[model samples]
Target: MTKWSYDTNGTPGLDSVHAHALVCVTFSVYILAQVLRRQVRVTGLVVTKFFMIHVMNLAMLKLEAGVWGLVFMTCTLLYFYETLPVRYLPVQEKVVLITGCDRGIGHNLAKQLDQLGFYVYAGCLQKGSEGEQELVRNCSSRLTTLQLDVCQLEQVENAVNKVTNELGNKELWGIVNNAGICFVGNVETMTTADIQKLITVNYLGPVNICKAFFPLLRKGKGRLVNISSNAGLAPVPEMGVYCASKAALATMTEVWRYELQKWGIKVATIIPSGYKTGILAYDKQATAERWWRSASDAVKEDYGKECFYAKPKTEALLSPDLSPILDALVDALLSKSPKAYYYRGIFSRALPFLYLHLPTTLGDLVMKVIGDWFISKPLALQKSSKKF
Candidate 1:
């Protein structure tokens, strides 16, 4: 080991290193201010001056005791890279396909992307339906409404053919697998058919679309954006089957990302929740009632009716605006270097960190507490002497 050396000026070796680290940190913060100032000019300046000051102070002390100034510099440079302003590709001449455009994020995205000058193929379950008509009426002639029930393979293939014919010489820029269905209920209360329905629409639907469109994506060198959920990251009460299906999609998205890298095709997943979407049944009470009715006698007896009624009556917490999700999707498609996962909406990132980073027991306790805030104990369980 090398002996510790003292500076002639009276500063200790460790103290000298700490001073160097602090100086590096201060310099990084100044650089950050310049970077962020530019970002503000371009992107409305969400980063506050106060935040920059706080970040500088935090970063300075964070590595004061460390001897490795090189490590500190490397981390600072990484931060600079991540914090830099995002650049988006020109929307003109881009042809993008979006599923589940009948409502919610898909619908909004189709319109927004259309407005941004992209030739949008808005896929709806029902052609000539009110939603489809609304899109056609509002969007330019560039936007086309296509019938796409993602669960149907024939429909997916037909859509591919139609798109291929339309593109002829040009290339497709992006595909957003926004089609999905959500069913909320206790795991035991959900019938096999119910679970299958969720899987078919949420998981298998994306698989079929991606599989069929892989060639087109490869040809276009385009990106694939899958609409996932925060529920997929953590176990949410009453959304067990829905969460599982999204989790499957999330996993497949990762695999697709790795597999498509060689082809220059980017794959991204948008993790969003608590947005006012058609998939979210507004009348939770009615949904609970439906689940209760569908439950077998054994399930009914085991859980009891009172327990199921505890589901939230209204999605009062869901945001009416879908701009955050739309912006995320746009980034996933148009950014030069798209992130593998874009977490949007309330608790989108936090829920995953809680589950993945916390101790199992602590995480479970926290989850249970959150669950209990919205739902009461099952009638049968309350009557039993045993505790969960």
Candidate 2:
């Protein structure tokens, strides 16, 4: 290969390398100019002025192709800069109500919002619970703890009334429907009552809360943030009821968004991947044993006891830090323009994309492969067949 050469003016003297670099830089600048011009149409005079300044700089540095490329790249960066989600409204004058503040995300978020100057109504199932006590100990007068059980319509209505009384003339800026529960067992193992409880707490709870708080939200032109799960987007075998409940809530949120938009109330759903929360901090083996024992004799016979008893080797996939989810919730409540849906945690966004975009057969195959790898096979079957 011939060595590249450049003249004192920085123009290509001889060699294909110099020529190729010049061509690449020229092509990049042309694309950048077209993009900037289109952006100018949308962004108006500001982008036009910025684009013209870069164009002038590029012309002045024509001999220095590298400088030209850098200038073009900077313009492209500026084009996207305007799209960043950076707008935030004042929280000091706002009042936000958060359910499930006994622990986990709700507890942390209530404290955070209170610190950020919003008057926070921290709703807990047990008024004197450890989590509630800790919140009271740390939070200032701005944070008020309320005994709220979303599943109880009377309690929800009473909580609404209490908030209304507290607010008086001030509007309720937002409501974070964070209360939920999970029951992990196969569909065959789950009883009718189990399913009902899951749906009642996870799905209908948010629905009831939203219906009761619509007037407050409308008055403030505020937000409705529902905390869903990654399981809602895609099912896991043993978590059928939990997944179904979350899926229902996610769908309900979408419908409510459309209906509530006319009243200037924003509805947002946060579908988070597994995080280290009290929800998952349960005795899986004990729960599985109960499920196995409760299952019908015929069902037990069909699926062997060893199969039901064998615990899968579940890796610790829960995120320790809850900031990503908390940040998303804050954005939903306080951002000038919030997204309809916010997905957090590992594979939260990617798995949904694959499920929605992949071919049906391919998606099914991928799920089967994932189940085989992650879900342990029955110990008895493995011993008999010498295969997993």
Candidate 3:
């Protein structure tokens, strides 16, 4: 915007003649020095400087133009900050169907996306569930709630059909496979039904949704977002079944990433940490409650109530708030070149990268320290042999 002598566009050209661009370029001169001062790695310095330089150039243009320059810059930054699965598969005024929107992270995402102006197709287990209805009501013009149980193909198809009718063969944005469940227990005591339930709802559910929606997504060149967890990376103590399901999902995302990349469709696995939502609210206290009741039930045996409920391992839970995690997932869904994996959570950044980089034993040791610190005090799990 150098008040450039471009003479043609009436705007400072982004070239050798522009002093503003030069000023913007000059900002990067000391960026490396600033990074070395902070002892940050040159790699990080490179990324930070790149973004900063873009911002500076953008700000200069904003001053040169009307407010649109700033708005465009903000939007551009956000666009690059995330990757989505719809480059080759493009959709206009497209629809996105999300599962498990009745509660928890799913509900949060449904609400956020609808507000962002996408035609949000929400699939929930039950119609008029209080939370689901609230979101539908709030989402208003952009939202549509369909009753869907992912385990049932017919229900899924019905929702798809409904969307098709509304869309009339229009391209679809695929599905955000977000619904999932959790449980806590040693694998020895874990029931087959429980394991199957986790697999059904968490693993098979996404596959089912993907299979049914691929035609639509193929048309739209859409993306599929698999909401996974860090437990998928480092297994959790009591949530053996939960961990298995997410780990299965992580592998599935990788496979889908390779398989679907050619179709102009992208599959992104958002492996985030556990967050507080309806499910966490249910699981956090209910886990302890179940332990309490089960302890009462088992008290008559040798290992009494104290061993189960009062043990230190069950005391503290690692659940963080859901807002940030949900925001990240929504962000990934909107990205134009979504990645194979995105981690979202405070601890998520370090933990999963560590899982990929650290030596197995060292990673386990770090995880073990986490296990020892985050759980209820006087962890009874310490007496056990199984690590996960």
Residue pairs in clash, model 2? none
Clashing pairs in 1: 40-45
Tell me the tens digit of each residue's lDDT in model 1 across 1-388.
Answer: 2235566897546543445446556755765676565432244442453355446545655645434544554465566456555667777689999999988889999999988999999999999988899999999999999999999999999999999999866789899999998765667766677689889999999999989888988988989999889888888877788889999999999999999999999999999877888786546677567878888887788788766664554478778988888888988888877888888876898888898999999999978876775556766777684764
For every candidate, C-alpha RMSD to the true structure in Å: 4.9, 8.4, 11.7
Q: Candidate 3 lDDT, tens digit per residue, 13-122?
A: 44332544454445445545545564333455457647764766666565674334444544544553333123222234668888999987788888877777778888
lDDT of 3 at 91: 30
Q: Which stretches of candidate 2 lie over 4 Å from their true place?
A: 1-83, 306-315, 372-388
lDDT of each: 0.80, 0.78, 0.68
Model 3: per-residue Cα lDDT at residue 256: 89
On the 0 to 100 scale, the lDDT of residue 178 in model 2 is: 94
* Residue 270 miss distance in model 1 (angstroms): 1.1
**Per-model TM-score on C-alpha atoms:** 0.82, 0.76, 0.68
- Per-residue lDDT of 279-310 in model 2, one digit per residue for the tens? 86657678667777788888676556654543
Question: Which of the numbered candidates is closest to the native, going by highest TM-score?
Answer: 1
Cα misplacement distance, residue 24 of candidate 3 (Å):
9.8
Error of 1 at 55 (Å): 9.8
lDDT of 3 at 184: 55
